[model samples]
Target: MEDILRQAVGVLRSMWRFRWWGLALTWVVGAAAAVVIYTMPDRYESTARVYVDTQSVLRPLMSGLAVQPNLDQQIAILSRTLITRPNVEKLINMADLNLEVTSGPQREQLVGELMSGLRIGGTGRDNLFTLAYRDGDPKRAQRVVQALMSLFVESGLVSKRQDTDTARRFIEEQIRNYEEKLTAAENRLKDFRLRNMALLDAGGRDYVGQLAAVSAQLEQARLELREAINSRDATQRQLQGEDPVLLPQMPNAAGVSIPEIDGRIDAMRKTLDALLQRYTESHPDVIGTRRVIEDLEAQKLKEIEMRREAGPGQFGSLNANPVYQQLKLVLSETEARIASLQARVGSHEARLAELRASAELLPKIDAELAQLNRDYDVHKRNYETLVQRRESANISVEMGATSGIAEFRVIDPPSLPLKPAAPNRALLMLAASVAAIGAGAALTFLISQLRPSFADGRSLREVTGLPVLGTVSLLGDPRREASERRGRYAFAGGVAGYAGAVAVVTAALKMLQG
Candidate 1:
């Protein structure tokens, strides 16, 4: 600790020995630094605050019907894009900030400088944002800030309107496309129906039902025809018999003995029953069968009355015999029934043939119809969705036009600054004083190192590594010593005077600036 203290004391003494040179260097450097600081151009800043209103009175009423703009997101986008080249150019033109820039590179450099000087920020946890610009001229700074504010607000509104219009136009285009598709589908379906109306009408019965009905009717008709032919043959044979002229003992009117007529009535009744199983009573075949049965029964009753009134064997011819006549009538009726049944069978066969022909085209028609229906359904759904969106977009546009739902209000207007915000003179001067002192100390140390001298015996021993044996003292004339002392005082006075002059000049400059 003692050694360190001694070293510090030695340095202070060496500095004091060259105090005049230190003072001169200090004053010169400090004055030069002060001048350079004062000559720097002053920069002024202007700022404006804006508040965004995100809520509106009509918002609740139009909640699901209209789109709501995101104010914070819009503000973030504006902050990033506000200083783009095009916007900067617009600002430059509006503010007349020519900056004497004519070439492309020069203009680009100017834009960059302007962007660097401009600042946009959002206040913490609020809907308020600030726009600020820095420039050498206070008025220009204020003008730039005002221009930024106007551009930001106008751009936001214009962007929102453009988005709304775009949405509406897109929906309209989709609706037109879907409308054309739906119309085309409908036309195709109509044409298909018109081309195959017959098949479509029969489609209601289904293939299985039609086939079963036609088959059942064809089998029944064949059975009835066969029975009728047999009955006709049997009646003719009975009429050819040798005893055909003789009548059987006549029974009561209620108990007629006409086997052929009775058999015909029974067959008709069986047919009616079979038909009833498959068809309603109102069906044409059922009605026809019932009528035939009633007629046969009436004929049998008439024959019974004829047999009761005729005497036994009075009519000798087979045609006059009541039983024979009855048999003949039955035979003719059976033959007619056979003919009618043959015609029905033929008609049924023809209908089956026609159904088979139509069935061949069903698969192809179904495929095409299914595709058309699918397309129509898809287009219909898309058209409906687009229509709803279009209505919503229209509502949003109307709301934007009428209401200030996402509006920017200039809460704090830009103010023209009277004083420069940069080039702090007091701070600059203090820094200059510190730098000057450092430089003065460095110069003093350099001078002392160049003119090396031992301050004490230990220093001499350290440099030479030799022993110091004796000390010598020089005696001088009194008058010469006194003259040297006076010269030293004069040198001190000169250095003080120079330092005082520099201080006075710096003070004068500061006063003039004020």
Candidate 2:
């Protein structure tokens, strides 16, 4: 610590050796800096404060029914990115700052100046923003601030409209896509029904249920058919009571089955009669039906031959007895009904076989049907939601037009600055003086290092790395002492001159600031 203090004292002594040089340098630098500071143009700052109110009375009321925008976030982003190059150019135009710039470089320089001078500061939480611009002309600063405010307002409105338009277009496109999906789904369902029409029952049950129901129906139909056949046989048995008459004419094929050849023959004749009304006897259906009747007649004749071989008796007719005729009619009707029921049962059996064969295919069809239904429902639901949202968007936009979504209030109008806000002359002058003193000290220190002087024997010994054995004392001279005193007076006058110069420059700065 003692060595450090001694080193500092040595440096001060070195600086003191060139004290006049330092004082002269200080005066020159300080004067020059003061002049520059005084001549520097003043920058006036203009500012405008805008407060964004994101909270609206309608927001809570229309929460779910309307599409709400994030006003705070949008305003914050706008405030930050508003100072873009395009916006700067716009600002220049609005403020008439580009009228004088004829060259490309000048325009670029002006754009850069505008961007740099424009300052935006705000907090998203508060939703408050301050737009500021600095310029040499106070009126021009105010004009720039005004132009920025106008841009902010216009951008906000334009952005809101653009967002609304984009959302509407998206929703409309989705609705169109969903409509196509609905059409496709309907067509698919229609095609499925058409393809499976043969297998499907009137009841809208799955294929397994249809199979069970059809089996049950077939059993019931067969029971009825059997009952009808028995009734017809009983009627035939009653014909045996008709004086042993028409029994010889009928075929005893079995007790349960009476020969339905007569009833079939009657129905075919009726059909033939109907066909004759629509077409000539030469028609293929008439020829085929007539051929069937001839074959049946041959079978009847063969049955009679068998009956005659059993017993040699003449075939008798019971058409004379009215009771026998009535019984015969009943038997014929019953046979007809039994034949129709048999056809129904056969159809049912075939369907049941088809269902059993398609057991694996049934499940696949069912699953496919379920998937299609689910997809159709999903698309429908999404389409409905998008439609409702579109309505809500329209409502929101209308409400915004009526009540506004957000409010941009000018809390403070653009301020017209009257006084300069920059170029602190007093501070700059002080710094310049301090720097000049530092420069002089540096110059003297360098000279002292080059031509080193040892004030004491100890320093010389330290430099020499040797022990000092003795010291020499010089006698004082009156002329030399007087010369030393005069030199001290000259140094004091130089100091006074430095102080006076500093005081004069400071006075001038104060007057100019005023």
Candidate 3:
């Protein structure tokens, strides 16, 4: 410990020898720091607060009527993307920042600077944004912020309108497609109906329905014709058995049964039963069957009325041969009825044959027609819907143009800064003073190591590895003592004055910054 203390004292003595040089170097470093601090440019920050009003009364009022965009999310995205490179470039143009830029690298550097320096704050849901920028020039800082604000609002408007326009264009194009499809379907259906006019009727009668009607009529007619032939054959047999000379007396007034009428009624009843098995009574075929039965009954009532009006003499004359006349009359009546039934049967048979031939082709046509009709209806519906959507889009565009979708209000406009906002020179000056002191101490320590000296005989002996018989001391001179004392006072005063100068500069800088 004693050796270490002596060695440290020896190093201090060496440092004291070069103290003036170290002090001068320290003062140079301090002055350089002060000069740099003084020359640093001041940066002024411009700030703007924007409140985005995403809510609109028109939004709810036109809910289903118009397309509503998520304005809050859109504005949030705009705020975030506002500091992008392209936008920063546009901001430069808007602020005329490119006027001084002479080269592409400078412009690129400016863009990067704007990107890094631009600041935006606040959350999407809050809809409140703060844009800030700092520049050496206050006017330029304020201009940048103002241009950014304009760009933000302009981007929102342009992007929104573009979105709406794209949607409307797509809708319009689809509408045109559906319109063409609808028209084509209509023309196909019309052509099909025109080509097969006989197969289909205005009452929606197709091949199967026509075939059914024809088959039923043919069956009924055959039945009626068979009855008429039987009646006519029976009457002819009876007339062959009876002699022409043996005139029978007039028969009693009791009326005979109209078997032919009963047979026709039975045939109609059978037809009704067949139709009922396939369709409800509400079906057109079923209704027609009931109406035919009523008509047959009405014909029977008219026959009865004619018989009563003509009297019993109408059946046969008492003076003439009653049985011969009655038999002949029955034959004639059966022949006429058979002729009418045969004609009806022939007409129905021809119709049934024609319908059956068309059945092969009719079914395909019917199915295709149904499909076409369905497709047409679907296309028509979609076309109508698209037309309505187009109208809605137009309304939205008009509304956007007139009323504005999102309202932007600047709560705090960008303003020119009155004072510098950056550099923090006071703190830098204080740091420079501390650094100067440390540099001076380091310089002295370095010099002490380079020019080593021994303070006593123990250190000298240790360095030489030899014995020191004795130590020499300078004569005790008061003049030398006083001169060393004065030198010590001067070194102390130099250090104190340097420290005081640093303190004064730091204080002055702090006042200037404020």
Model 3 segments more than 4 A misplaced: 1-39, 84-86, 102-105, 200-363, 425-511
Which candidate order results from sorting by lDDT in descending order?
Answer: 3, 2, 1
Residue lDDT tens for model 1, 1-514 = 9978877777776776676677778778887887797788888889999987777899888989987767678767776787877888898887777766789898888899988888888864577889988788899899899988888888888877777788788889989999998898889878987886755534444455666777887898888888878988998888786244444453344444666676677767777787789878766567777777888789977776676578654322223456666766677567547645765677678777877776767556666666776787888888898888888888888887898778789999997977777766666676677777788888878787777666677767877999998656668989999997987897678667755655665566556444
lDDT value, residue 511 of candidate 3: 94
Q: Report how far residue 444 has shifted in candidate 3, in Å.
A: 16
Model 2: lowest-lDDT 10 consecutive positions: 250-259
State the lDDT of candidate 2 residue by residue for 1-514, as single tens digits: 9989887888777667767776666667767777788889998999999988888899999999998877888888888888899988988899888787999999999888888878989966898899998889999999999999999988888889899999999999999999999999989988987897766666666777877898998899889988988997999899888752343443433321224456556765675676678767765556655666676567767765665576634333223367765676676566555555665577678778988998888777777777877888998899899999999999999989999778889999999998777776766777776777677667777777777777678887998999999888878999999998998899888767766777777777766776
How well does candidate 3 match the true structure in TM-score terms? 0.54
Error of 3 at 326 (Å): 22
Model 1: worst 10 consecutive residues (lDDT sum): 312-321
> How much is 12 displaced in model 2, in angstroms?
3.9
How accurate locally, in lDDT, is each candidate? 0.75, 0.78, 0.81
